[model samples]
Target: MISEREILVLIPAFNEEGRVGEVIRGVRKFLGQSAILVIDDGSSDRTAHVSREEGAIVVSHPFNLGVGTALQTGYKYAVQEGFKYVIQLDADGQHPPEFLPAFTSKLKETEADLIVGSRFLTGSEERMSAIRRTGNKLFARILSFLINEKLTDPTSGYRALKSTVLQFCVQDQYAFDYPDADFLLTIHRSGFRIEEIPFRVDPRLGGTSQHSGLAPLFYSIKMMISLFVIMLRKKSADSN
Candidate 1:
């Protein structure tokens, strides 16, 4: 219902040619003129071509950069292009675009710096195991303890942010892992307020779910350690 805000949606896709087009189409159908950008992280597949053909502005990387790199590209584009708001979504068709209206509506009203779309905060349409849900909750608790932020879903990719907030700070420009709560700590250290919006999740259509096993292990160790180091540095900065 809230149409007063202008926001751009950035989708970081890597070899998601089969699924990116549908995502763009769904986003366009739901959010006309809202601007969508698909960052192709050096995908060998037809990701860039399909995205451009589907009316999404495409930015391609020379090779397979991680999700963090793609996101940074999207952030830079959003900042340079004078966009007021930016929502980051996946290109594999897991994010339910139907719920975007609620996220945007809250962003307009709350003036929130970062708005994260949460699955545990609401119902999920996709089938998930209890172990995964428990892992998410326990991780969320740990994140709340470390960062002391009221975050429910630290790993949820469906997230929104004001352009000003995005401009405030970022870390590990290219080598950053999955981001999640650890990356958000960068914003928290900068003293920005983050909001969480409840949303549903759906099964992906093509490609594969990227989060699992060693990738997640890498994400947890590197991203957390990096954030911890940042927290200490931030504390030092505050003292001085």
Candidate 2:
């Protein structure tokens, strides 16, 4: 079993100055000042400074890269720093830190390479637009069929994974735009083990989602294409 020191809490933030701090504090409250890494994705605001002030290790990008890139950065850092496990959640405050223990416990018990927190599995619904809700269900169904597993929320950002999984994710082939369903599907197809646990998602505390506006429409199309392309490609030889 992995010790607390082997785990890292990674939060990717872009323009989430006020909310990110709260997220950091919440993690510290449970984990007791564990190694919390915040990837400040080129925010024009003081996101980096605030994260540092909250006692999190901050890695700042010079310009705004998408959330996928930010997560890749965090994974890269975790691998380089020799973290045995990584737990990532949104900085928008939607993913509650209270669920961190549940993720850790499930990871320890199942020894799964990846543990995804599902908002739908517990019958708890997060307040989302009708279009987003429909899109999530559609993607979930498709991914479940593809993976041959009963997955409820494939687009969930709250997740925990072993560092060995990051070795593949840090590669250039990993998606950089919106990792969502495509990311999870690629990992699952690559022979990595993935499991999901139910968790409650709170409303966003501040700032707009990168997926706001016409992005969702583009995301849906792009994700479908990406998912199929992943299916066509051969599984990675480097997979565990």
Candidate 3:
């Protein structure tokens, strides 16, 4: 029963001034009436200004606090503003606005707590670089094994979340760096329903990925350690 008016389109940007405006406009093209908010993650460029110019409500952080924190900010705003649902998109133009309706419809039909637009799902036409693909496969396997559910794209930023999930995201339990497989596992353990749909993602129109270079290796290591810690904590709690 969530209307478009009750849904917020949240775009998190970091030094993506050249691309954020186009993303905003694209979202507006389809869901023109839906409120669009951009979390400018302390971009040194004109990300905030360009987002504002594109007619999106911009919330700029004082400094770069990472993608997870920026997303948390969006969730906080959604909750405070009384939004019933929130759809997230990247500011780099990889996430297509054309699929916004598909997300909305699927959300309504399934009533899923979270709907992920997965590039690896059936019918998706998107392809990744060999290195990125290999990394994604590794993460996907780990997440599937941990959560006991097959997830094709656990790291995808294109997703829609219900108000309950948004509330959870604003709490202390959410991840702060990359809310990927680890975050999904946490949500699953909490008994939230998650579903994924096939969707194609375009190559980045501009800006560099935060996961490029040695960052992926470091991120993978951190995620593995964090997941282990979470499992141990859960086991202890259950034993008590």
Candidate 4:
């Protein structure tokens, strides 16, 4: 059975050698009482060392797994360690640690199974690339329509999930990037509640963006096609 109320912050990092420490420190400040786990997905830099020095529990992957796999590793750790909640944040420093409270607050207010830190709700236009921002908005709107609930930032990487939500996330064959694309379907299929937390994004402290133009375009298309397929399958099953 899943535990209740406890939180474990999960930091999935890749090649964030310079900014990892600051991001971890920022998170530690907000999560003063919460547990933290840093999944170093085969960083080619000192991300692991820096994160450990900053007081985060560092778990290293043998090779660079995709972001999805890194997240799954954290989730597995949370499940094993008996944590009640998990927060997925980037180590690149774009996702401010100060905004963690918004997610925790929404969790309490709505008793939601998943809480996504959304840039739209908080109104950030500073660093968002036009194409990427437009894609996120379009995807969020599409997901909201599909799930029958408003999702402010469907593709936002900053998010929190209740432990019970792990059941859906851990199934074999579950792919990465679901947190951005298939999150609504995963929760809706499992009868879990999802909420959005408004948060203003800050400019990344160091390193270039891991995703931007071509990455966002490809990812959006892949997710949309997958979502449509799932919906069609669901519809056929329902009708049957």
Count of clashing residue pairs in every prediction:
0, 0, 0, 0
Ranking by lDDT: 2, 3, 4, 1
lDDT of 4 by residue, 39-145 (tens): 99998889899888888899999998888889999988988888878988888888999888877777667767888788888789446988878877888888888
C-alpha local distance difference test of each model: 0.77, 0.88, 0.86, 0.79
**Top-lDDT structure, candidate number:** 2
Name the runs in model 3 displaced over 4 angstroms: 122-126, 235-240
Tens digit of per-residue lDDT, candidate 2, span 88-130 = 9999999999999888888789967999899898766658777
Q: Residue 3 error for model 2, in Å?
A: 1.4
Across 133-159, the per-residue lDDT of candidate 3 in tens digits comes to 777778889888987889988888899
Give the C-alpha lDDT of model 4. Answer: 0.79
- Give the poorly placed runs of model 4, Cα more than 4 Å off: 1-5, 235-240
lDDT tens readout by residue for model 1, 1-240: 344236889999998999999999989877876988999999998999999999888989998879977888888888788787888888888897887778777887895688888887776723555656766776688778877777888878899888656675333432455767676666666666778888888788866767666765665667557766766764422310
Worst 10 residues of 1 by lDDT: 231-240
Query: Which scores better on lDDT, 1 or 3?
Result: 3
Q: Give me candidate 4's TM-score against the actual structure.
A: 0.90
